[model samples]
Target: MVTTQRLPASLTPLDAALAAVLRDLAPVQPIELPPVDALRCIAAEMPALRAYPPHDVAVGDGWAMRANDLVGASSYAPLPLAGLPVWVEAGAAMPDGTDCVVDADAVDASGPLPQVLAEAVPGQGVRRAGSDIAAGRTVIAAGEPLLPRGLLLARAAGLDLVRVRRPRLRIVNISKGGLAVQLIADTARLAGAEVVRLKAGPDIVTIANSLDTGGCDLIITIGGTGVGHTDAAVNALARRGALIAHGIALQPGRTTAIGRIYTTPVIALPGAPDQAFAAWWAIALPVLDRLSGRRPRTTLALPLERKIASGVGIAEVVLLTRKQDHWAVLAIGDLSLDAIARAEALLIVPGGAEGFAAGTLVDAYMLRE
Candidate 1:
């Protein structure tokens, strides 16, 4: 089996490494799932099967009658009805030839013939057909998340299932299992991926065997990416398939690696939480987005509260907190757990330029969606 004998002579540019990671990647195939099960999944185009409220229905519990029949009716001058009006509850289909609803008190059924004491204009208390949803109209657009509101529309349209694309992500932890893997898995799940987690020792053969891409669209190996004696993730990837880049020009995650095995792309992250997190946001998430066909994530553009100083030739991850309409710098380069936890958003400083000055408007991605 082929193996990378040593560390990369020089770190690969972050942009170049990302391009290699995303080369020829495509979104996963769509699947049919119950609307409840599709929550948080990226939706394929889902057209409404039928119009909601297939027929006009009452919006409140009242007497269903012809609006024209109640003309000039009032509590002081009650108008006698020709026949007893239908008593309908809220959400019930409006009686045939009826156009509106009147309150219970408005209809005096105690007498032989009900007397109308209120007037209701047409559709005043009715929900019109097709108002909530139209037949053959797209309820959930492609690449949109399937939220509870979407499910309500689906159910109203008589749809039992929805079509969605949820990419399968396999995360292999090559270090002693701990918080790093859990953090990555949680992040992947939050990004709408189906995650399968596994653990492998530091042995090259074990890691190589765990690189199987049977049901996964992407693979991420946590740890075993540095030059330490036990760092064998990159070498194992070379043995299994191809090691495209073994080192990247990103601070806190310089030891990260990018490669491919069979048809699936693989990313190797440093064991440290900070470095792994940096590489994940900078490199892995873009690949995941391609696999899931997710729409572009929202980014907030706000002025910086303070100046940020970053070194040249290495991309840096900056954590920030929103404080009184400005982004306050929490931490840069080496990030602590507290800083990461407290950060509401994150910004990546490109490798070519110095950091932004205080009060410069910067685009940052929210940590939580």
Candidate 2:
């Protein structure tokens, strides 16, 4: 197995760790896919070929007629639906020369003809053409995520497919196939990436060096990142190329490592479930987002309900819960399944600060649970 190691101190600053590897990366080429499969993907360019609705349609079920025919009409004296008056249902295309809609609720349609008891004006209750969207107009920007609202817009614009940068990822794990592999695959796939999870057994060094990375934009090793003797991913990747950072200043994630093999970026994460989960979001996911042409995830502002301690040199990721109007830290012995399962939000403590006291206003990222 290949061997070379760039030893990092017990803890490395998170910002330094990220900068070393992200500087050389670029987004992958955009691919065309159906709108349903492109959720969360960054749009390359989206222009509508036709305007929404495509024609002037009625917004209500009423008589389609000229406003001049309804002049001086009131509850005391109603106008009859005579010449040129056309009966129109909601969403029906408005015929030529019609300019107003008189809802059935405001008129009596029994006995003779449909009539309006109230005066009507031009463009009243009538949706004009191109009001929603115009043909050939840019609907979405280049870097915006294709959220549900964006999908609706695309569908409305008569688009059945969208162009997006779908990243291809390789996830390396110690197991051949199981829940762990499934979880990692789901995480990467849900973020709009095509994933391939590889298993590296006892001879992780050999497997790591031989793992197929032909079309992969990024590789994430799910275990063998800690100080244990069996951990050899750091050395294996170093021999292949450059090891950016071996450790990050993060709680439950200090064992994380970021590097590059030839032209593909590789990241090493701890085996423990909680630590690996945190590291995925704190590190690996960000790399995937950039490679897939997406912007950073947004965070919210929330106040800490109680005091929480942390070392000055390393950043801490604390799980928080919603308590009435504010957020409170959910303390646990270590990051465990129970702890993560109960968390509703994540509180970040940067490396420069020592700790925080009660009522301290801090920025947080809400968990998707």
Candidate 3:
């Protein structure tokens, strides 16, 4: 039966809602993936299998010679070479019995007897063995995102694959999928989750069946989370699993719901783009981080260019853009499409606080790198 219900008498607190969503959830096990495939994934500690540059190599195009041989050698008192020094190209392994490299011009090769015109210091212009990487050393630490720079180091260490934790996310669009769903999917993917998109309607059975959590670490349902007659996401979740929070004390996304099917976490977002976006930052992001064992996201502390007035009862989402050195508020409480698109960062005002005054230093989470 389709059971219609009224709005929640009192909305659940934001922190309590988040705690219920994270209850009994643990980080998924790490998997082996190629460095290219592991981009943005939470990396597992990777120990170098072998030392890089196992042998001394030239760092530049020059002649390899013994630094001791060129001691006190200068243009005024050129040291004559018994034999022409070995020519080594950049990146080539230095020949045995050589400890330094000198530029071609430093060697007077035009003359029948080559003479050293400049002194060379030991280890100059040469990359020593294990200088880039040491054997058995930790090159990539655990709980950090595997970026391109980390991948470069992995490749240099001769690692074909890296270990990372990438959570599988299933997005269930409870209505005709549109831009709102697309935005959520893209955001989840960018957060290092493998996204799978599904579709359903407002019908209880259809929405309940689509809530299946098999093979996915998390599920996010878009649309039908409100208290209207057609809003059946909360009812469907209650029938299929445990509904943790049906209404949250958050602006723009008050109808958002949190639940769990079996062991997988599920977040039901409203259909509106602004509402879904606000919930994404305030709720979904924390769940993703916990599932992937990701480290704390970076936030910038900057002063607000102007005063922001907010209600004291509900947590409000604030969109901001960097202006000169301070953060300029683009929109408060309800964010518009234009504001969301133009926002460079986001700030959330606590439920207890009314708002911030001008020149108040506030921490904002970066939306873009």
Runs with alpha carbons beyond 4 Å of true place in candidate 3: 48-50, 134-137
Better of 1 and 3 by lDDT: 3
**TM-score ranking, high to low:** 1, 3, 2
| TM-scores of the candidates in the order shown | 0.95, 0.86, 0.93
The pairs that clash in candidate 3 are none
In candidate 1, which residue pairs clash?
none
Put down candidate 1 lDDT per residue, 149-196, tens digits, no spaces. Answer: 878888777788889999999999987757889889999988878999
Judging by TM-score against the true structure, name the best candidate. Answer: 1
Rank all candidate structures by their lDDT, best first, as comma-separated numbers. Answer: 3, 1, 2
The regions of model 1 sitting more than 4 angstroms off are 1-6
Tens digits of lDDT, candidate 2, 283-339: 887888889877656666777788888888877788888887677878522576776
Clashes, model 2: 0
Please identify model 2 stretches exceeding 4 Å from their true place. Answer: 1-9, 48-50, 104-118, 134-138, 175-180, 227-229, 331-333
The true-versus-predicted C-alpha distance at residue 69 of model 1, in Å, is: 1.3
Q: How far is candidate 3 from the true structure (C-alpha RMSD, Å)?
A: 1.9
Better of 1 and 3 by TM-score: 1
- Candidate 2 has a TM-score of 0.86
